[model samples]
Target: MLINLSGVDKDNYTLSILKSLEKHNSGSLKITVVMGKTAPHINSIRQFAKTAPFECQVLVNANNMAELMAQSDWAIGAAGSTSWERCCLGLPTLLLVIANNQRTIAEQLQQVGAAISLHVQEIDTPKFTECVAFFRQPENLAQMSEKVVRLCDALGAKRVAQHIEDLTKNEDFANIRRATLDDCRQVFEWRNHADIRQFMFNTDELIWENHAAWFAKQLGNPDFIMLIYQVNGVAQGYVSFTRQSENIWEWGFYLAPTCSRGQGSRMGRLALAWAFAELGAAKIIGQVLPHNIASLKLHEKLGFFRLPEKNDVAQFELSLDKCYIKKQFHSRFKIE
Candidate 1:
C-alpha cells in the first residue's frame, strides 16, 4: 500500500493512519510513505518506522510518485491533484478530504465508485482496516480499477498542448518517419521490456544477436516497413507493417517504456493514417493476445473490427473506409 500525506497537517493525519496500520498484521504488506520536502513530522514517522510491524520506506519529496503508485495495489492519500494521477493509472484509493476545498473531489469520486472518501476526522483503525480488507479481494479491486481509469486518461496536458500548437503554429505537432539503423538498439530495448513482452504472442526473452540480425533484415526489405513516431524530434514509439498482399498489411506497434499511458492512442491514430493514406493499404490487420486488454481497447477505439479468433489469438482488421471515418472525427490533428 502507498500513503501520501503531502498537503494536509501531517501531525494530525499521519499518526491517525499509522495507528490504524499498526493494528493490521504486516504479513506481505509493505508501507510506502511520501511527504513533501519541508513537511513536518519527518522525525515522528522515522521514529515509528524503527518499530513498525510492516516493512516501511519513507521518501521526502520523491520525484517518482507516479512510478511508486503504479507499483502499488491501493493508496491512501489526500484528495488533491494526485487523485487524478492515481485514477489515470487505475490505482484504487481511499481519499481523505483534508480541507474544505477537497470535499467535493472526494465525494464525487466515491459516488462514481472510483474511490472511498472520508474526512480526516473519520480516520480510525476499524475504518482503515475495513477498506483494506475490501480492496484485498481481486474482483473488488478490478471493478474499482475499471471505474477509476474512466475518470481520467492522463492526457489532459498533452491534449491542451496539441490544441495550442494547432492555433499558433498551424503545423503538425507529431510526425512519423521511416526507421533507421540508429534506432535499432532503442527499439530492441523497448520490445524486450517486461511490460511489452508480457502481451506478445511469443513471450520468450530475445537474445541481442538474434534481434540484431532480424532488425537488419527488416531494414533492408522493401515489403517490411518500420516507422518511428516522433514528437518535436523525439522518438516516442514505433510501428511496423509487413505487406501480406498488394493492398493488405499486417502491423504491430509498441511505445517507449517511459512514454505516458495515452501516447499509444496518438501513435495508433498516426499509424493508421499512414498505412491507409501513404502506403495505400486497403486493409490493415493486427493480432492481440486475449489478455492484452489495453491493446484490445486501443484497436477498437481506432476503428478496428474484430474478426474470428484463430489459434486462440484475437484478430482485428481496419479498412480504408473505416480509417477515413476515424480521421474525420479527429481532423484537428494532422495525420501525416
Candidate 2:
C-alpha cells in the first residue's frame, strides 16, 4: 500500500496510520510513504520505517509519485488536487480531509464510490482499521478502482484542448436510439450481470427464454419505449420508459457493465432530455431500491424530488419544466 503525505503537514496523522498498519502488518505487507522535502518530522518517520515489522520505505519529495501510485493496490492520502491525479490512475484511495475546502470533495468522491473519505480525527478509530481491511479485499479494490477511473481517465487536459478546437463545430457526443432485435442478446447479458441485477427489483438470474419473450413483448408494446444510449456509435447504456398516463412515464436505466465511469450521468442527461422533447413526457417517475444509493443520488442530482416511500421502495419524480431549467443552467455540456 502507498501513503502519500507530501505537501501536507500531517506527520502525526501519518504516524497514526503507521501505528494501525503495524498492528495489522504481516510479513507480506509492504508500505511506501512519500513526504515533502521540508517535512518537519522526516527523521522520526525514517526511524520508524527502519524498525517497522513489515517492509516500509520513507522517501522525501519522491520524483516517482505517479509510478509509485500506479504500482500500488490502494492508497491513503489527503483530499486535494492530487485526488484527481489518483483518480486518473485508477487508484482506490482512503481520503483524509485535512482542510475545510477538501471536505466537500472528499464526501462527493465517497458518495460516488470513487474513494473512501474520513475526517482526520477518525484516523485513530476502528473505522480507519476497517478501511484498511476493506482495501485488502481484491473485489472491493477492483470496484473502487473502476469507479475512480471513470471520474478521470488522465485525459482531462486533452479533452479540454479538443473541446476548444471544436467549439465552432457542431458535434454530438451522445445520442439515444430505439432498441431493436439486434440488441436482444447484449441486453440480456447486461441485465443478468451480477452488478446490474443486484439493484434490480428482480435479482434472480434470468433465463434466456424468459428474457427473449419479455424483450419481444416489450418491443411490440406501443406504451413501452426502450432506448439505447450510444456514444460515437457504440451502445453504452439502456433506458426504458413505461407510459403510466398522459405525459407521465415510469423509467428505468442502467449502463453497460463495461461502460466507463461518468457515462451514467451523461446517459441520464441524454435520456431525460429525449423523454421530455421527443416522447412529450411532462413528468418522469423512477423507483429505486433503498440500497441503491448511487441511483438515489443520481436522481437527486438530476433534480428529481422524492415522493413518499412505498413498501420499502423509494420513488422520485422530475417534471419537464424543472429539467428544462436545470439544463439551461448547466449548459456547459450540450445534450444534443
TM-score of each: 0.48, 0.48
Give me the overall lDDT of model 2: 0.87
Query: Which residues of candidate 2, in runs, are more than 4 Å off?
Result: 1-172, 325-336
Off by over 4 Å in 1: 1-172, 325-336
The stretch of ten residues in a row with the least summed lDDT in candidate 1 is 325-334
Per lDDT, the best of the predicted structures is 2
lDDT of 1 at 94: 90
Q: What tens-digit string does per-residue lDDT give for candidate 1 at 202-224?
A: 88888988999998889999799
lDDT of each: 0.84, 0.87
